[model samples]
Target: MGEGIGFEQPETVENKGIADELGRVLESVPPKENYPPDRELQRSILDQLPENLVEELHAHLIVVEGGKEAESSAEESKLRGELFERLATAQYGRAEAGTQDPRLAEELSQELVQLMHDPRRFGLEEQIGGIRNPDLAFFKINDQGKVEIEAAGEVKLGLLTPRAAHQIGGGFREGTRKMVEVVNRMEKPEDSGLLAVAQSRTRGGYLSASENLKVKLIVPADRNPEKVKSLVNRGIFPREDYVRLLELLKNKDEVEILKSAFSRQEVAAMADHLIGKIRERYK
Candidate 1:
């Protein structure tokens, strides 16, 4: 009911004395091919939930994510898009609940609480203009606390095949290009640098790479050349830009770009595991 569920500033959120408990529970999580096993990642996040937001957070992860057959499903994409847009309504968005899309706004209200808990680490919403908008845009605060856009993020909801997952990287390239173009247009071409985050829902575990790269591609979904080509032709990217995007995809490190794409069953398995953890702690 508050700006971020029960009303709190995103940056000032504290551990609520649950970090140690989570750390203990996390030890039981087995290591997987990806860093920070899926279950463990879920448990870690569980410890961060504020009391008021727990129920809503649980619904967001389970109910909303459950209704999708594929991560790219139309309904799922639309909801995710709404979440991204509402999240940018400013930290304590003044938008009255009555004036907005009730279901979508409610979900965003819940997710926003989690996101604000770590604004710097997660890009909430990056809207620049053109078809180049990122679901979440990462930022850095200047000395005066002014935010400067540093990176962009895209979120997908399904386990991808190796070929199908390359879409995320393509998304990254498109987002970075847009951010850079915006910076240049503002007459600060030196600020043309940007970072990208690729977030996806997978089955095996929560995997992340690029401890040493400018762009951060976190999800390991697969790719489909045909589908990828279709998306490109749809005008997500201009022809020339699409060509470069393809090169970026080919030159990208697979180990770094995508590890393995999973199935809906896998997505359900991971979410259920996480939801169970949340219930154990809060219910």
Candidate 2:
């Protein structure tokens, strides 16, 4: 819509079968009588997924069992986090047109067309922090085709609980500080930065009580949404001022990337698929 951003249609991805399979798996999930649902029941449902689907969806999955007390190991969590990071990168690259939900697909396509324009590139896990790394970064290509950093972003994925929400806030605070510190070390610091967080579909509730509190504590009153939509729909919420974060770390929390590109249905299927894989791996 501007100099760098353009409206170019992304090539259609042939993933109807994958989408249909994911849909079938989601539809098969019984209505949850409880918030987290029974662990055995959850495990059994995951066990029902076809082995091939588990393999195909592994890269898109984040397996977290036992609700508050998650059973996933550190290595497993690290692997899942990295896998989700890559998945988010690919989703941004493709603009998530492969999702089954038509409305969500259209929204993603439009956002992608608007956000990803010519002469810009998206990357994952750049070592922007001396001891830390932002999960995602955006680069600009000059006339000579050399890539230069336009912006940097951090990514966090977990259930949208109060604890997770607070963790996201703290993580972004520290990560953003690192980003600013590193950028300042350069001859010319980037004007702005992005802090992104995403939540899994294993648990449901948009802007849950804890999330609401965290949002109220961080997000500006005027900018905060009355009802926070799924992260799939709202991509990046940019803030112009970076110094505000450096100066007032607690008061002005500008989180740019807040949603996962994957819709609820897609995340559900992937979570189930990963649960199956994790069970086998740990057993």
Candidate 3:
């Protein structure tokens, strides 16, 4: 694991039942089918800007969003300096002559402002890559008192359908891969009491026939054994990654935390804020 990529024992969080109520609110705010910004408008504006300005902004955007390193050439730096001087003089002249707005300039300015803001409320902007966030995480303190991931799992929102199983399985792979790395970094490289967990809204019928169905399907197990096995063979199932599935409904404290983190009202309010920002920007 990278020095910066270790997990911390999360502070005990207040559980306000966000997960339990998310489904009800989802009916109204439905997970946005998609949330990309107006790419055409952005490109059109960039086309008119000085190459230096556009290049600088693009590089800045990459760094801000992904922490990637981008170094500007000396020529580009000189060009940007010259453009800034020219713009300063132009602005002074415009101020002296009384302000006037050109449609293209105004449009370009608005687009730049939006880009600078990098609105993320509804996932409007592209996110950083190579980071996988798991739903449930287990942590253990090493002898040095560093909190490390013991076990973790990726969770899907619905019952274990073939699709959901595929997603969860993929998540399990990613989560366990990281878990393996974190464990290797431990001072005492023994098995961490941590175990990966998989879950869904309900266990569903597919997992109902397991010998220890009640414990394995902690939240609820799926009933389709054949599909589950198929998904597992396809490397989409987390069965091998985790010791077993965990039902959030059975883990009282975890259920509360899940609910609090995914509450309907909280999600709605966040979405509403982003929508309002978009409307105001476009209006």
Candidate 4:
């Protein structure tokens, strides 16, 4: 998206229920003593955040969300900077597997374990890339020891079906709006047991997408067999990338987090690097 379109960025949030859930999973976080404003870092992150999300950042005591000027305030700005960074980060979203396949189930289970240990968990933005949703946030202990880690990540882990993707294409915004509604209602946050993140509506006529409109999605187990493996055995629709995505999450060596951390340029580079590595690793 370009400037002047007037799209706001989304900010990190703490829904009480979501926080409690995270506490149960990860324990014993300490509190912060010196609250300082990381104005420079905040600015850089703000630049990455969608414009609409500007309000969220400023809402933070550390960030001046008041646009450039408030950001300059070297006073209370630092006092609250620690709190804000604890609350926000970028996360990667998981695609749905659509079955109880052992392999897929195992992958999701491992992801949950990682999510539990990670202070900052992020899911990639939907196909749009940079624009992120609340799926990556979690409740964890902060330096201040207050209830931290807000907006627990909840995703419909499934491979988009031709039919579902078509539905998503027709009403991308609408579908996302509904997904947000579901996430908002979720409070427990215990890895949500692989709720079929993807849902669909079949009824036509006199139908207005009732919340009842849902589809049977995959649930995670220890074993998730490939439903389409037979159809595309060797490097077909069952593209090695998806399989690799599942496997990488299980093994530490195969995957490497950029030491440089996340940046738009770095992410682009990672994508290219992954592409180049695919032939050698998957084939």
Best by TM-score: 2
In the order shown, what is each candidate's alpha-carbon RMSD?
A: 15.5, 16.1, 24.1, 22.5
TM-scores for all candidates: the values are: 0.34, 0.36, 0.26, 0.19
- For model 3, the stretches where C-alpha displacement exceeds 4 angstroms are 1-136, 153-163, 167-175, 182-257
lDDT of 3 by residue, 1-283 (tens): 6579655332212212322232233345433322322334322322333423334444443455475433334323433333332222222111112112232222322222232233242232333123333333333322232323333323322234444343343443343344334333433321222111111101110101111111111111122322333223334436543223233223432222111112223233433433333334433
Per-residue lDDT for 9-42 in model 1, tens only?
Answer: 5522554434344444444444444343454444
> Per-residue lDDT for 113-209 in model 2, tens only?
2222211222212534222223444432223322223223444454233333433445533443444343334332112211111111111211111
TM-score of 3: 0.26
In terms of lDDT, the best-performing candidate is: 1
lDDT of 3 at 152: 31
Candidate 4 ranges with C-alpha deviation above 4 Å: 1-133, 140-149, 152-261
Candidate order by TM-score, decreasing, is 2, 1, 3, 4
lDDT of 1 at 246: 54
Off by over 4 Å in 2: 1-20, 27-83, 94-130, 159-255, 263-269, 277-283
Question: Mind giving the per-residue lDDT tens digits that candidate 4 earns over 10-124?
Answer: 4323233333332332222232233333334433433333332323333443233443333233423332232232323322222223322323323432343243333144232
Superposed by TM-score, candidate 1 places the C-alpha of residue 214 at a distance from the truth, in angstroms, of 7.6
Residue-level error in angstroms, candidate 1, position 225: 20
Clashes of 1: 13
Report how far residue 99 has shifted in candidate 2, in Å.
25
